[model samples]
Target: MGRLRRKLKKTLIETSETGLSLELRLIGQFIIFLVTIMLCISLILVATGVFKAGMKQNIALFEKELSHLSQDIYDDFGNLSLSSVSLA
Candidate 1:
């Protein structure tokens, strides 16, 4: 009876060790997954901010160019109108 009990106890210990090792491995995998997700989120946020700044700069440049073009058009039209009136 004593030897049988010892054997059973040894078996239980081995089983417990295997379970603990598996649990530890699962926890480690979960931690790695969480860290990877955080890294991806941070990268996406940085990319979004950079894209927004680029778009704003492009918009400003377009507005400035449009204003210059409109001014040139107005000056040309004014000069033509004045010369036509003088001729008439």
Candidate 2:
């Protein structure tokens, strides 16, 4: 009867679980947060790479654009070697 009453008291307790288990749980959560931040940074770099590849144009496109702008400036200038930027 004493054993049964003790078991019942244990089941009805308000405070439970050990400190070691709680500390392990907190450490696991902190590690997850760090990993999540790393993954997010990696994703941002990947997105910027894709954005640059599509928007920066190719070597051929850049050269063709430069040739056109230089031709336009030459027609207007008397004999000046002025540099220009072609922004899109």
TM-scores of the candidates are 0.44, 0.35
Which ten-residue region of model 1 has the weakest summed lDDT?
Answer: 15-24
* Model 2, span 39-59: residue lDDT tens: 999899898896467554687
Clash count, predicted structure 1: 0
86 Cα displacement, candidate 1 (Å) = 1.2
Q: Residue 65 deviation, candidate 1, in Å?
A: 0.5
On residues 1-88, what C-alpha lDDT tens digit does candidate 1 reach at each position? 9999999999999978776577788999999999999999989988889647688889999999999999999999999999999999
Runs with alpha carbons beyond 4 Å of true place in candidate 1: 1-47
| Cα lDDT, all candidates | 0.92, 0.76
